[model samples]
Target: MEQFYTDERNVQILIALLKEHGIKKVVASPGSTNVTFVGSIQQDSFFEIYSSVDERSAAYIACGLAAESGESVALSCTGATASRNYYPALTEAFYRKLPILAITSTQDESKIGHMIPQIIDRTVQPLDTVKCSVHLQTVKDAADAWDCNVKANKAILELTHGGNGPVHVNLTTTYSRNFMVKELKRERKIERVMTYGKFPDIPKGKIAVYIGSHVRMSKSLAESIDLFCETHNAIVAVDPTANYTGRYRVPYMLVAQQSIEDENRNPDLLIHIGEMSDMAGIVGQPKSVWRVNEDGKIVDRFQTLRYVFEMPEHLFFEHYSKSLLSRQNTYYNSCMEKCNYFWNNIPELPFSHIWVAFRLHNLLPMGSVLHLGILSPLRSWGYFPIPSHIEVYCNQGGFGIDGNMSSLLGASLVHPEKLYFGVVGDLSFFYDMNVLGNRHVGENVRILLINNALAAEFHLFKQTNLTKVNEIERFLSAGGHFGCKSLDVVKHLVEDWGYEYLTASTKEDFEKVYERFITPDLTEKPMIFEVFTDVNDENEALRRMYFIESSTRYKVKNAVKNIIGEDRMEIIKKIIKR
Candidate 1:
């Protein structure tokens, strides 16, 4: 049989990244599962191989090689009883600060609980054994390949990150007999530049700087990003929680609703910054993504990550903005011009979450704090803007329906004199309703409970498949829970609990009650404003996001969808595309 690499993508990525990280030394033990890994590297002259028949001796040999050469050494062995021998050597590497890549190849993990031979659960390791361990599962798609690429890079990087230490790669493999493969497909290598390294040259293309759930940007950091945007013709795509109130900051949630093929909307390079974010319902596929964070760990959100600049985001922008000549803002202007189409047109919507958001978005008093429930409230309000002085917060960390009200109440405690407002669904309100009885809730706390008696989020986007089934309300949407949006149910309970309850069942009622609910002035008692709507209207309002009411293109498409029915129109679209 001709020598070749394994068809297994997980092992392929690990082997590729090892060479990319410049690791050449290895100690391999005889094994069935790791034959793919050890076999692949053995044929290449790039690796200086040392064979150890005993798995116990291989890890210790790796430690010695790494320590003496002052370079990372790779160790390979099979699963079950093989990797247990690595602990003592790994612990030594952990304490002594030596970089050792421990590769433990395992048979299919699903066979473990089925009483299959040579199967064991090595999912966890002792704290002192290694600095970090990442398990790479079977790669079936681009997402899986990207995940393997990232995990491999992190395990390799940890060899020197924060101090040298052993890192474990618990890789799962599907046993394959075919071995005619000629080459290792080129893999994505993400280079992490340290503070001492020079920043790479910016690629000349349409650049998008994505700012997700970031803390408030300092004046200098904001200025750095602004100058970079001006110099490089870049635009900042702001997640609602990004809090980057700069001239180049574009409200992107609505713009994201546009077509992905829109050249004016998509970017060639997407520079990601800050924490995990709600990128649901977004469009456009960037050619590549680069992440910037202080932690220096690889976070491949878009799967096309090319580099990770592990430093302060301000330093990255400031370094890039050094230009003697001023550049044009054509890219930024193009994106904003596309976004303005949705902003300038205000369509008449039925009483729904988005309708309420449109009415109350700019009406909220400046310098106030606004807390929102996840899913519906975040998506609705993301289409608009909050004043830079108004601090926006949510349980975006957990993205749960619970604790939204609790978060608002607790945040109000920090500044009792400042107005604190919250917009939560009836489901969230009912789950955390017990908190209302707490006497500590003050007059500064204001709550808006939008009660549609339906799980609008669960049903809206899934209308296609879910509607094909029956009895979806009870289970799919979890609808008709907690008083089923009865007008008196909450009003009576809250009133008795020392809260001033205001209920709105129609747009007229909302018009009458909304002014007092959002008043910046504090009332004698904490207030609850409950607005009610129908499930149909809620879904319709959400569907309007796809069709800008003013555009004749979308208007005609919407008409077709209505006339021929959504299901048939979808079929027609598929045929048209083909």
Candidate 2:
């Protein structure tokens, strides 16, 4: 008997669903089983595919891209060993709340217990780490496979649409290429629009817009919020990549919250966006507060007097601006006025790192993507204003430099046509230097290394005590061959490694070098810009920064404490006091 329906449509259904969801990026590893689905995806020009030779990097690259974009990104690999390769990234993504969709090939269900070559507990291997795992059986079992696909897609959307996190989808080969295209098309639901409820009355004056570590929200939202702030004369302090300061145009950020208290400015309202963990300790308690969260969950880190877990900030501001009345206050303006004075009186140092970031922000191509490493480079980006449209990514959720080059390479793979920049420290670049060899990465990606010639962060410790210099020098031995930093070695990297290198010794040199690097010949492959600085001067700047932020010194101390974690608080206490 000839069957009227076929299972071949399932893959189309799932891929079509992904396309409908605006998931334009996919990271894939070479595998035999996923050939059909990959072929289909390739045929469709809607989604871009980044092929990674290493499955582990493939998964983390997907994690990094989605984390940066605040959306769901997919990674595909074969079953068994290939699936196992994604575990580390899966755990990290789960904990960090990055939305990573993964697909793995599988053996037929009939061979489940027959000791098949690539068979393991596929359904349960990452059960503990993933939000949900669906065993997509077969296209003939449309009731089962499509359900899993829809559920997996929904989980990703829910994870990211809320606070931006990761989720896993375990797709089996038997179901990958099968779907009842007609039926699935009738039920497809894509693109969810977030809406927010009304926030409480704003204080007539003294409102502060404090931006935390965040990505997402439309440009229209920023403009509306700016208008509201302008109308109310609110003090807007933005964290890195918030695009908050650009609209305000004043030095609208404080390096430390102690600065706010030092200036004797307390606020009636503390409207916060994104993660508050970093700023929670400093902002202290607010008299009244409101938070806009995508997931509708309330987090009272400061135990503020009031709470509102509205939808995305953009939706909230859009609604508020239409109905809410503006209230101007003197205290808010006074607080901002002092912030203005601080900016005007910024100490004339030899050269500040923020100046470097400010210059790069302009030099980088407009509408480009920047993958900023989590250490000094990320901190500098906080003070510098970025173009509102230029997408920025960092490993701030669980900051690490171990995979700096690989992660950016993966991101570049997904969007090969767009200009991509990897902003990393010398230490970070050395850690993952091999990623530079990934043939998948080409002219689209650039490596911008801020080479201060030593561990920039450790330089701060050298200032605390001259004895720490010896300790700092020890790190140099373990991180890279000393030859890598020698002038000869750097030249070898440019001439032999096939990377176009540019070095900067002075502030003026850096500005000119950066301008040229930013305006690259897009027709050619990506280039690397290695900006060199003096190790001694870098340390001096950090020491001065610490002194300027002594009241908030506990922030750095807490980071050190986290090394031992809560279990060894007693040990951390002794070290802090020492």
**Mind sharing the TM-score for model 1?**
0.91
Candidate 1 stretches with Cα past 4 Å from truth are 113-115, 259-261, 280-283, 550-578
Q: Taking the tens digit of each residue's C-alpha lDDT, what string does model 1 give over 237-294?
A: 8777787878887877876775433665557888888786786224257778888998
Which model scores highest in lDDT? 1
**How well is each residue in 444-504 modelled by candidate 2, as lDDT tens digits?**
8887877765666655553466435575566642434545466556557554666777777
Residue 344, candidate 2: alpha-carbon lDDT: 45
Give per-residue lDDT, candidate 1, residue 21.
83
lDDT of 1: 0.84
